[model samples]
Target: MIDSDGFRPNVGIILANPQGEVLWARRIGQDAWQFPQGGINDRESPEEALFRELGEEVGLSINDVKIIACTRGWLRYRLPRRMVRQHSHPVCVGQKQKWFLLEMLCPDDRVCMDRTSSPEFDGWQWVSYWYPLGQVVSFKRDVYRKALRELAPRLLPMQEPASKHRKEQQVSRRRRQERPEC
Candidate 1:
């Protein structure tokens, strides 16, 4: 629900594979990709909303994922001027999200886009932990970056230096491939 600040209460999911790659999904009929997220219902707690959204968006239940950590407080971002709906009740201009970091404990086959009648994503893939920070929509990039940075240490143990370095290098390679050569 929209709050007095003109921001909606929402939960953002950063579902990661054991190797630390985060889940990225393509919106139905759209090329844009993002992490799983949804608005919280008035009666649902952030944690409750997270699990519900996870199941609806990615077909995962509590049994399939382990909640690693969550943000201490809400992290918010404003919609661009053109996106704000001036006529809407509560005048929501953006989202104030409680971000969750979840580890996928089940097999990949467990993820299904059509788990619910209205699917949030059409297709999904696992990407480097830092990839979403730069790849998500510009309006949400700052929040995504902040969320990932804050949760990384918890997801990646300090002893896994070599693995972390490899992941970063892989992410760099993928970014280069996504760009056109000048």
Candidate 2:
């Protein structure tokens, strides 16, 4: 719902695998990609919205994941002026989100992007936890950095065997460098 300040209450999901990578989905028909997120319906708590959006967007359920962490409060980002809908009632200027970090318990094959009639994403892949920082739309990058930074500590334990983690980081950096930016 839109708040008095003209921001929509929303929930953002970061679904992480055991390897510490997070789910990155392509916007339905666009080259642009992002984490799964949706607005919180009236009278619904952020946690409720998280799961609902999780199922609707990624085809996952409560049984398929464990809630690892969440932002203490909302992280906000403003919409680029051209994207704002001036004619809408209460006109949302941006979104204020409660970001959630969920650890996937189900197998990878279980993720179904087309589970809903109208899917939000057409394709998906797992990427290094920090990859989205540079890839997300610029307007939301700051909030993404804040949420990922705050929730990252909880994923640290999953990165055990320091030497291996270090090696992975080295490889990840090399690949990221080889890939061209969008």
Name the 10 consecutive residues with the lowest summed lDDT in model 2.
Answer: 173-182
Model 2's TM-score against the true structure: 0.86
Total clashing pairs in model 2: 0
Where does model 2 exceed 4 Å of error? 158-182
- lDDT: worst 10-residue window of model 1: 173-182
The Cα local distance difference test for each model comes to 0.85, 0.89
Question: Predicted candidate 2: what Cα RMSD to the true structure?
Answer: 8.7
TM-score of each: 0.85, 0.86
Best by TM-score: 2
lDDT of 1 at 72: 80
